[model samples]
Target: PQVVSARFECPSCGNIINVSQDDTSFKQPTKCGCGRKGKFRLIEKKLIDAQKLVIEEAHELLEGGAQPKKINVYLHTDLTSPLTEKRTNPGTKVLITGIIKELPIMTRSGSQSVLYDLSIVGNYIEPIEEDFTELSIEPQELKEILDLSKDPKLYEKLQLSIAPSIFGHERVKEALVLQIFGGVRKKRDDGVITRGDIHILLIGDPGSGKSQLIKRMSVVAPKARFVSGKGVTGAGITATVVRDEFTQGWALEAGALVLANRGYCMIDELDKMNKEDRDAMHEGLEQQSISISKANIQATLRCETTVLSAANPKFGRFDPYMPISDQIDLPVSLINRFDLIFAIKDLPDKERDKVMSRFILKLHQNVDSSKEVPIETGLIRKYVAYAKQKCFPVLTDEAISEIQNYYVKMRSTGVEEESKSVPISARQLEGILRLAEASARIRLAKTVTVEDARKAIDLMQYWLSELAMDKETGKIDIDKIASGITTSERQKIVGVREIIIELENKLGKVIPTDDIIKEAETRGISATKVEDSIEKLKRSGDIFEPKPGFISRL
Candidate 1:
């Protein structure tokens, strides 16, 4: 502690004595040259405010899979004020302007040891606005990034650069590139906030390179934390409330998601997670926040993180007609939180197989050939950081019109109440707008263009065609993917419930299952539909079987 000023009044002779309290121990006026010593009153004392911060090195600065190192920085006076403390939160990147200092370590007897610890006494503190600006870019690198952005084939080059060793996933790669350069976070005048981070899920066959892609992304993205779903508990994914021994109260310990705020968290084998663990992530992915209310502590933590997860379909194979929640062990509620879902199948194609085979063989023959990405890992990270910091794109009138037309067209497909096959929802519209904003950011554009809108629309359409197609009606049914039951199946279930109600009104509490089936069949509903609907009703707790063939409303 550095003392600014101190004053003392002597009781022996009523003389006011002043002394500079610069030492850590309380300094006093030892003598006034009048044979006086000790017992000086500390009437006034002032100390300089100070705070210490631990700063971690950026991931891009490490090479050969090394761990990042951390250093302690000491802030003084105005730097330790409450308003300036926001820039020093757990995951925020900050630049320190200061001088290095060393403190000698004390031994057991309170004697100074030979060893010393280093620290920085900061004169200024500045927070970096971008997500991963800890990887500071040089002037030459900025020039190269600007030139690359101007290239006509920049989009193609960027797509090819993501996971290049994996053959032929141009669409997934393109989406991944946009995910790196995410949309700008916005808050409306009404205090409603919209998240900018993108979350993507990959569901496919076991050997379809899902884990490989996740690992590659983890390597490419700066400050990315990788975790296996089966290995993490619910508290490890979100946060935990535990007793704080020092404070004698409760404290929220942030887990992987909260710790990776404004960064990336790549989860692998998501199907292996427990239901409770998946439930904990739902709020964080959608709302970009995690709330904790336990053990007398209540607070919300910001987790503006982008997530890329990969999971294998159940039974180790991809089935196009099945619902996503049915194919994977994840719940539909959890699956819907992902902005984009891609079902990658491993069907055999002669030419594509031959090329992939050649590519793998050549990689083994010459390891150097595996380095085929257009941009190096460090430069790619810097480029993304630069674009995110400098670019903030707003939707143009033309782009807004394009998005409006697409949303209206998709909404019209599910207009009829009888079908109720909703092709899209408001979530998808918001996702498309975010993707368009990301597309503009990648090119450092100030406004989202019509072409950007079309790119986003095309990607959404691709996802619809792949994962949301209903085999029965041959139309894009979002419910088929969002829920296990299609609209037609739901309608049949409703019809069966109505017939059961009519039978109960006339035939007393116990109605035979066969009588209900016969009534459903008379109304053009199939016997199979009736059976499925009865089982669904029983499972949903609407009706129950009292005996072998008799059903009753609960």
Candidate 2:
């Protein structure tokens, strides 16, 4: 075999270096020794004199058994000019048809060389297009896809294919799978489409797979885009000002939402998104369109994209007592935009620990993945494709009734105490239906069953209870924190607050916190409970400390 030397540029670092190769083929690691890896690919190559081929023509030549001897091409075009106002080089996809005349060789003192040179005889440039296909499907077909009870192994396989290397958070994985296949359109009482997409918010601590989950969905979903909230401006998300091609003046360019159109957009570090970006998302979340008149270009861009977003708690970890609005550091407007919010707190548990350990071990070592592969990754794609081609089924009476009851009970039409002020909104109800539909679609069920609705509700409830309900005050709350409270914590705080208030009225003068603690004990409240309640009241500003170790009613 003749030895040939080639340069391998690290995709991450863009460092060009040389490697020796025999004509024999081999698998190479997708990493460079400089601790950079996984986010790069072979971008460009040059060839000469034998033939100049673009990707389409190259494939055609391969089919026709015409193998050119040597080919050289240059990648020198500025890509991403169509999207960004600054004309950033996102990347390029090109096709060429020409003849190669010469080749470049290496003259080295241990130096790397560029491969292949070509003399262009003739060439053709094909327009590069973005893939924007969203899977379509009927309701009956979706139902059949989700009815996986008859084949447990198939269900497991599907999960494996979708999740692949995902570890822990089985609940999150299941929720995401449902969201992918679920239809996001809603028929209102007045017969108009209100909301047509599923909006999910994942609030978690650092390293909780929030970003990983979003990335995974981007790959599994038929059409998806992953963006970072920190990097995305308001114009980057909904629509923004750009220079017009025809008039050579500024115009509005559609953001990821408009570009994604009928697919999914996974946003990472959503809490880090600017306030203006948060404001822009509100309308798109409900109206599914962004209306703007920037640089004299008035337009409403379609943003009918299912949003899967991840955020960190404001305080870094969840504290059960604070209002969610306080804990998350996100505006109520943006928080309410999501149909469902999940708290991915890193709770320490034995089974979870074991699973995590295994997951890490598998990644650190090249263990046998043959037996671990559950479903054909390709099959999952086919299933999603099939569902997209089918029509969506309407909700049955049982499913509708279950959803209606849930909305009526948890969400009040009128405001009550701090505890009751419409826990779930009408938009959330629609989200529930979509999630149920998605679940059914995954199972290949013809129609969404009552069981599917309950499953969705169960998961939603778990999330709401932790993220929305405040255990210290028994109030519906949101916060920048990651963990919530047990019901008992609420009762304890309320009880202690009551005792402190009674002591203030009975004694007339300010009572020391210890005296209030004694009074609480006489009223059957433990010292711990008294302290907990005092802290809650203090946090809420219901009581104040006029002196050290003393309490005053606010």
Candidate 3:
């Protein structure tokens, strides 16, 4: 046998045993010098072509069924593809090698293996000395097509793509587009754009098309990722630590947010996440980075990705009788992190019912019903393809003033002392502008006009009105969840409070539960009303328990 190389490793007794392989089948020493031995297998080294190396070879060769290992692939060509190169590029091109190493292993068969997925591991380009040559080809025309300012057909396509996929909720669709190409921006004390990432929250009913809108966004955007809240964990959505092979140490692995940097991440079922996990996301949403210190890995990973999330109310639908603060399962802090929050309520009306029925029937029957909607899916793709490559348009001062006036009046009603001081944040300025730009893009226009801003602001106003209201009172009843039903309850709570105060003052001591109920009835309050007030006061900790029957002020 042609002996190649000898290496020693002891499975037991931790001693080295020499092992070698040749052209023929070989056997290992029966025992180790440490008094334990068996046949040891020899490690082999081989070079394979880049394209020929599949995911199976990576798992079998590198991981060896223990853990996945990272291997380098020496690509013969750069992935930049000269056809897609831009003129005003800032030398930000990353050289990516064509390799399929870190893919998910689905199943394996003899001489065949299946991989779930693959990703591009990109970094600053480094020039290799030997066997490396720059290949030149015609610059790609993709950029020219994406420049909507110069391309009319591209804009036409984008309008059609979103026009059909999103039915009846044109307002939500407009907001989504602004989030995409418009890109959110924040100014620091120094007047620099500090927070440039955009985050949108959709709080709506179960069938308000929030899910459908997000699904459509995943397809239209060039670099977009969609994930469900129930499907992701803190470590999975953000980042985690894994074993490192080169230094024989643990390395931090990038999560979905980090991997989707400079892109869009659509998260569904936002309310189902754990409180701790949701809290962990606050920093990423605002600062666009995840700072985690665990297992000696103290690093801040980049998460400058736009987030589009959807959630249902705590009790399945919006309750107009309750505050927006009390209706959602998520915390106010997390909700405030979103630049814009749209409420989608399912209202039953004749026109809506007829349209919904016709739409569903046509969809299930696989028939083309909206032939004259002026836009097609292919056109939408072309429109987005073009819009991404163009410079963003500016919203004129007239548009800004219009939006400011609308925002100021909606929030200045002073419904409650605990309400938000500013109905709309400065961040919304950017949101509105972007939304207008997208609306213009849908029309395949060169500039965002005042009419576009008006439409966007109208939608924003509707959402703001729904979110900021005293459902118990008669102020801003947009969704009709507030009617004569809540006023009676409010009156009862007030009467119950009065009865408790009167009973306590007269008795000059703790009030017995039965006596308190009787006193409340004398004051024209029902037994049920008195009981509810007791429960509410107990919950609020205004009243405490001496026993189950006796109540005293805390």
TM-score of each: 0.81, 0.61, 0.63
Q: How far is 506's C-alpha from truth in model 2 (Å)? A: 19
Best by TM-score: 1
Mark the regions of model 2 whose C-alpha exceeds 4 Å error after superposition. Answer: 1-155, 187-191, 319-326, 367-372, 409-423, 472-554
Give a tens-digit lDDT track for model 3, residues 177-249. 6676543244569855455445788989988889988887876565567888887888878888877633457
TM-score of 2: 0.61
Per-residue error (Å), model 1, residue 269 = 2.3
Q: Runs in model 1 with CA error above 4 Å?
A: 1-88, 92-130, 133-135, 242-250, 320-325
* RMSD list, candidates in order: 4.9, 16.5, 10.7
Pairs in clash, predicted candidate 3: 83-140, 146-386, 154-383, 157-379, 157-380, 158-379, 158-380
RMSD of 1: 4.9
For candidate 3, report its TM-score.
0.63
Q: Model 1 scores what on Cα lDDT?
A: 0.85
Taking the tens digit of each residue's C-alpha lDDT, what string does model 2 give over 253-272?
56877767677888898888
- Candidate 1 TM-score, true structure as reference: 0.81
